[model samples]
Target: MRLLVSFLLAGLITDGEAQNWHGPHPWRANAVVDGRARDYNNEYFLHAFSYRHLIDRPSPIEEGIRGTAGSLTSDRLYMDFRYQQSFAFDDPDQAFTLDIQRAEDFDGSYDRQLVGFRQTLAQRWQLSLQGDVFSDKSLTDIYFGARRLHSEGSWLQLSLVLPNAYFNDKTDSQSELIDEPRTLFAQWHQQHTPWASTTLSVNHTPDATLDDRTQGDRVSSRQTRVALRYREQKGNWQLQTDLNGEHTRRQHQLDERPAPQAFRRDMASLTLAVRYWPHRWQPQVGARYFWLDEDGWFGREPNGNGEVSRQEPMLFGGMSLSLSDTQRLAPTVYLSRPRVEQTVNSPRWRDRDDHGFVGKLSVPWHITVSKQNGAVLSIVPSMRLHRFAFGGGNVQLHWPL
Candidate 1:
């Protein structure tokens, strides 16, 4: 924990001019606790803390803390802290940012730390470099990413990540278990017309895997994804379409032998919406179509010779209304056909031929605490109801700085 704290503190110290001395520093804290009596028990608790200060005339320090505790059938606790300092260059468009984050569990158990730097290269280009280290674990990841924007509201970006995993020989059975995972990704966005915009992105993870025998001999897992999205706004109507394709390969080593398993998924969706605003009454109608294709791994094969494939389609709609300038309400309904039972661990498991509908409603109210200083606050309470799915309620608070 000391090493993690040191890494974060080192990034916070930089040369800067000290302006007006402020007593302590400005800070704000917020917390939310919500519970609902559904057929099944559910509850959530969240807390956040924020602080900001001027380190110098042209440098500022910012920090935040986030924690969550709750039970959705299982109880979990999480806490994270972050600090960053921003310094300005001679040019207004150019600046440098150093950031650090540390996170741990309630019992001071598992911990992780990240330190990074961000720089504005030019008018439309930016770069970031980060390293993540873990406590009680000998694994580290170094990531480099960059973003660039064109003049015509178009932009492109790319990222490269390298992961290095190490194991301690004293307590571990394997003398040295080292696994390296490398990843590359790229994306672009453009506006085709005044009312239309499109985004295309592709990701490739060629070497992401685990090579520890004690970890069940998972080896050589690769994944690729390609996605496209288009949105158009015309008059009081809006149309959107999204398409995505994903392919994954996993190999398991049994007795030092490798066996290949693969899975591919394809999805497409289209939505059309129309809004009519008349005085205090605002009504919106929406229709949607969704299609999914799951191919390859489905379930444990008898002889490991055949592949499983399935398809599904879905429809959805929603509407909303503005109660006043400071208050609004909205509700949405969705129906979808499930295909294949998907789990976090195995891609082969998926749901098949299931249809259900879910509804969500939200109402938000705004209040101005001070008119002279333009201080405002908003509160929103929302609920979700599903016939064949899980539902919950949430409350949100917002304040402008």
Candidate 2:
């Protein structure tokens, strides 16, 4: 019965995200808390710069651009980890896990080594850390926080972030400039009950560095900046808002180097999302509205109000099906806001506002194997189709023990 129990209890985890499919067990996921530690190694490069000291993200131009949720997204392979072992799994009070990863890109441009760790502290506190070392440089990330076993779901965490030293040196005067950025952040969240909850986060970067991810450029080289977020959830609905307030001189670097164009900007955003999932056959309906306010460039850009105020409401709906106790299929439809777009690179004329429509079908599968006690394999395959847009899809695979 121990082997059968282990096989049934071992839940599948992918990209560090886990869901408990079965009840509690002696050697199970509940032994450790939080999903970050479960998948820290894979998100090293594509991670956020918070108090946790996560890995420095790739250059803006190198990062993956996300579209509709659950649509075909980037297949960028994060560090591949081979799990080694766990300590004191039966006792939920004291549990720990370790993983080793190879640091490199999908094309195998660079090579490095990474190690991840997660440990429970004094029963309620959770600690997670990740480190990486290349041939010439090394980076470290550490996080300390605690959540409750109560229904309130109250929690607090603080993280310190340090960027890569290789990118810190600003030497290239002609092109390709760089700087090392550091940040400190704190977050507090409280769930009064299943019906209501609130989360707030504040992060400060001593040296302002506005990373222009779309163009992969450092628009703002140096300045003091602060970013924060506030979110409140009630029932199946939630409202999230965030702000980026910084006093800095941003520039548009063109071929002519004598004097680059510069501007000062500020921005804020509010988004409301609501979801309904009462029945399996009834299409789950979701909707989101975004209000963007900006000044610096002139319209509706993040750094400017270029005189254009852009507000686009989106429509999201999907049907979820339960194929089995451990398997499910979900298909969704989306309607994006209509907007007029101009050619940026070539600088052309003739424009029209166009709305977007997309559809997605995703299947998630789980398998159990009693290898060395228990192991779970997870696979997710998805397909998407778009009207007057590029169609795409992706597949994800993971085996967790």
* Highest lDDT against the true fold, candidate: 1
- Over 1-401, each residue of candidate 1 has an lDDT whose tens digit, in order, gives 54233222222111111111110111000000000111111111111100011011111121322222111232432223334544567875555554444332111223334566667766788787766655534456566878797855567878776644343433245523234456676777775555566677776767444545443344455556666655555554445454555555544443433554444445444444444433233344544444444343222221122222333333334344556554445444434433433222333323333233334333333344444433334343334444333333223221212
Listed in order, each prediction's TM-score against the native is: 0.56, 0.49
| Residue-wise C-alpha lDDT for candidate 2, range 189-298, written one tens digit per residue | 55544434345555554443433333433444333333333333334333333333333334554232344445443333223333343445434454444333322322
Cα shift from native, residue 307, model 2 (Å): 12
Quantify all predictions' global Cα lDDT against the true fold: 0.39, 0.33
Best TM-score among the predictions, by candidate number: 1
RMSD of 1: 14.0
Candidate 1 minimal-lDDT segment of 10 residues? 26-35
